[model samples]
Each structure stands twice: as structure tokens, then as C-alpha cells.
Target: MIIDWQHHMSPRKVYEGRGGQGGVVIRDGKVTIHLKKEVYQVEKHLEFMAGAGIDACVISSSPISVDQCRMCNEYYHELGSQYPDKFFYLTPCLPLNEGAFDILDQGINEYGYKGVIISPQNAGEMLDSRRLWPFYEKMSAYNLPIFIHVSGHVLGYDAYDADYNLNIAFTREADIALNTLRLILGGVLTAFPDLTFVISHLGGGISSTLERIERYIDVRGEKFWTDCGGTPPFGAPYRENFRRLFDTLYFDMAGFEGGMNAVKCALTTIEPNRILFGTDYPYNFHTDGKDVARYIQDIRGLDLARDEINGMLGGNAATILG
Candidate 1:
């Protein structure tokens, strides 16, 4: 069974009132939106996911707020109750606000949420910045992994016109990739070595820039994102940081390209480990799971062991989510 860890459900107002993802039109960078009535509600969303063999999901909000986070978490909590083992969550967090941490703590203890998800799109400030260390410390103490997936969550940046659909789409993986790289080089990972970080969109552009980043590491002789403070690199960076995938860094298969590539890479690069199953659900599949299943069957035919497939589907998740 697949675990859709980065699914989104739109509130009716947002889904119905605005031109949803379907309405985005970009012509020479000019954006026009034709709003459509709600095409998919939670009922349709869950039904499709279930049809696709998804056993669980961690629902996150597309447009985020603390109250919105609370509502979404509560909604998922109810859904999980309805479906029993078929649903679970990475609680949406308002980590930028101090009070948000309190809400997160309550969400976990009171609701038994497994982890906390932070959207890089809507979240204005990167918590890895020094300003957010206090909150990070609390999360670290709780041993909760921080799940970040970029979404179309611009704050005051009006890249769009009247309707919010001015931007082509949000959660550009490239931006989140840069942020993830910045967080790593900026010292957040070093500071919180044990802090679990899960990136969506197959880690955005980082995969493409892997060689450049390594060169930067060799030239600067330091990791880019560090928390050691004092304005720069001190000594030789730890191999643990560079070799982070086996340590703490995780990628969820949450996009079409990203999800597919993530599985391929983990199988080859990490070799026999590190891949976690995730369908970026709530966004319906265009054709159906049949083609994708055939693709998986074809890929699986390439002489990999059954253990690898089983681990990719669930074992890796058990390790990461735990």
C-alpha cells in the first residue's frame, strides 16, 4: 500500500470561489483565471486515493494559516477515525508563530499526530533562520520530523493579479530546493543533527545541482547552511552532513516527475534503501493508476529483489516516520 504523505485538500471557498489549479492560464507571463465550481471534494479525493491503493496520507493545507492548519488537522483526524488504519497525518504546523508551537504540541499529544508538516510556499520565513531556533528546539525535543513541501503560498508577494491564480503555480520545487540547500549549508542540519527533514518534489532542483553544490563545498571548504553561528565556516565540515540521506534527509515520492525520479535514484544512489512511497494525492491522477502500475511492474522487472520493493513501499516509511 502507498502512503500519500503530501496530499492537499482545498476548502470549498478556495476551491469554488477561485480558479482552482485547473483555471491557471499563463500567456507571455500574463495570468488569467476562469473559476470552476469545486471539481473535487474530500469525498472524491479519498475515493480516488483509495482506488489507487493508497492506505494512508498526511494531509496538508494548500493555503496555510494557524487556524487553517488547525481545521485541516482536525478534519484529517476525523477522516482517520472514519477510515481507521487507512489514514494518518503529518500535522500541519504554524511554526513561524510562537503560539503555533503550542498548538502543534497540543495537536500531537491530544490528537496523536505522528509528525508536523511545514509548507515552504506559504511559510514566509525559513525556520532554519536563527529567529526560529526556539521552535526548532522544541520540535527536536519531541523527536518530530519536519515535513516541508513547497506549495503556492506566497504571502504579500503579489505575483498574480486580482485572483490569486496570477502565479502559474506554487510550490516550485526549485525554490524549496534552494531553501533546503540553504538550510543545510546555513547550519540548521548541523545544529539539529538529529532533526528529521523530509523534502517533497524530489528535493526540487538540488538533484540537478548536485555537482555544483559539491564544487561549492570543495571551494568554500564548508557547508553552506550551518547553525554554528559566528558568521562562517570553522573547520572541516562533517561527512555526516554531506552524507545526510542515510542519516536524516528523506525524500517523499510526492510528485509525478519527482516521485518517479526519487524512487529511481534511491534504488541506484543509496542502493537498497532510502526510498519512501508517497502519492501526492488530492491532485487527481490524469489517466489512472493502471499505467503507473504497469510502469512499476516494468521497473520491478529489471531484476531487483522483492525485498527492495517491499522496503520501498512500507519499510522505508516505517523507518522515516518513526
Candidate 2:
């Protein structure tokens, strides 16, 4: 069974309420800045899935405010319930807000959400901030992966500038990579060993940056250890610890155009089983210009063993979601 691990879903009313078209509208080769809610509709979504030969998908919302997280999750839950075989959804919660834990619990236990989606940054707090520990602990206890996606455009840049679009695209991946590295280097992975994190956009260039990161850690390990009170002796090599932490995390091939070099880099840096197929769906049409069928074909065309290909296509996600 083929699964698109990073599909997005937003309520139609949310778009209509804002006096906007509810679906993606491309003009002059540019996607308009609007929530494509029509693609999230049950019938339309299912039709796309069938056309793409996708058996199931894990859905989440387009980035919305903290206040709307619960409502959007509930809406997605209702949609998933109507076609349980083809859909599962992630719970959305503002980790820093009150009642966040309750919302997560309700989504998982009552609504049967497969997992949770948290933006790489909440307000000004990065994912590694202590404020999010309670939510992470709860997710760890539930044994579900945290789906990390980026929200908002590049900060401190002129939105109307010629390079705005390019900057936004670069920033999305950069932020995800930065937050991911923070989570690893900040000792969150070590502290919550049972917690699994599924980073979107093939870990946002992490595979290519692994070497540089290791070198940086090596150069700064002593100061970092001293600053943290050095209670745990820095006996083992830092690289070993980094590898252990990195191995525990998973990455999805979303927002990529089946670039063999990038895929090879990820395979070299991470285990095949830790890689999952993700299309980023409606948005992928804007970024990658390839449909779901072509995405499947691209992965199949890779120089991988049958079992490895199976794992990337769906097996890995099934195991992670379960």
C-alpha cells in the first residue's frame, strides 16, 4: 500500500470565511497565497488519491493560529472518520498553551489521531525550549512521532522584494534544519530517547550538512559541556553521541523533486528504514511540478533493493505511525 506521509488538509469554511477561493489557483505559474481547502474535501481528496494510486495518507492543517489548532484537528478527525481506510490525521496543538495536553490526549485517545504536528518554532520559542517538554513527554509516552513542519515566511525580509519568494523557500528548509539540529545538540533527543521525530523536507538539508555539523560540535563540545555544568563527563566522543541521536530521528522526502543526489545523500547519512515517502501534495505541484504518480515512479526508479524501496514507499511510515 502506498502512503503519502505529508499531505495537508484545511477546512473549506476557514477559507470561505476569509473571502478567498478555497482551493489552489495557479496563474502565470504562481500559486496564489490562499489556503487550498478544496483539495481537503473528502470526495476531491479521495479522487486525487485514487488517481495517484495512493492507498492512504496522513493529513495535517496548513499552518494556522494556535486558537484554530483544535478546531482544525477536529475537522480533520471528522474527515478521517468518514474514510478511515484512506485517511489518518495528526493532532495539532500549541505546545506552550494551557490545555494543550488535554487536546493532545483527546485527539489521540478519543479521535484516534495517528500522531501530532508541531511547527518547528512556536511563537519565538524553538522546538528545544523547556516549555515544550511536557508536550514532548506526553507524545513520547504515547509512542507517536512528532511531525515537524515550518510555518510563516522568512523573517526580517521584505515580502514584496524580488527575492522574497526565493528567501521564503530557503528559509523554510533552513529553519527546519536549524530546529532539528537544536533538538539534537540541545540534548532533547538524549533526554527523551523514546520520542520519535519525523522531519519534513528530507530533514531540510541535514543529510548534506551532517559532516559540517559534526565538525562544529567537535570544535565546540568542551565549551558546551562546561556551560551545562559538566556533571556528565564528556568521556565518549561527541560524534558518537551525535550519531546515536540522529539515528533515532526520521526524515520524509517531501518538498523535493526526486533529486537522486539528495536522495543518495540521505541514504548515506540515514538508514533506509528511517526514510518515508512524502509528497507535500497540492503544494508539491507548485514546488516540484511533479504529480503523485511521477513521485512514485521516481522513487521506484532509484537504485535501491526491493525491501528498501518498499520501506520508503509505505512500510516505514506504517511502522512509525503504529
Give the best candidate by lDDT.
Answer: 2
For each candidate in turn, the TM-score is: 0.78, 0.87
What lDDT, from 0 to 1, does candidate 1 have?
0.59
Over 4 Å off in model 1, which ranges?
A: 10-40, 121-123, 154-171, 222-234, 237-241, 245-247, 257-272, 298-303
Off by over 4 Å in 2: 17-19, 22-34, 153-163, 224-235, 286-290
Model 2, range 28-110, lDDT digits (tens) per residue?
33333445655446676666777777888888764445546767767877776677688878988777777667877888898
lDDT for 278 in candidate 2 is 81
Candidate 2: 10-residue stretch with minimal lDDT: 24-33
Highest TM-score: which candidate? 2
Backbone clash tally (model 2): 0
Candidate 1, residue 316: CA error in Å? 1.2
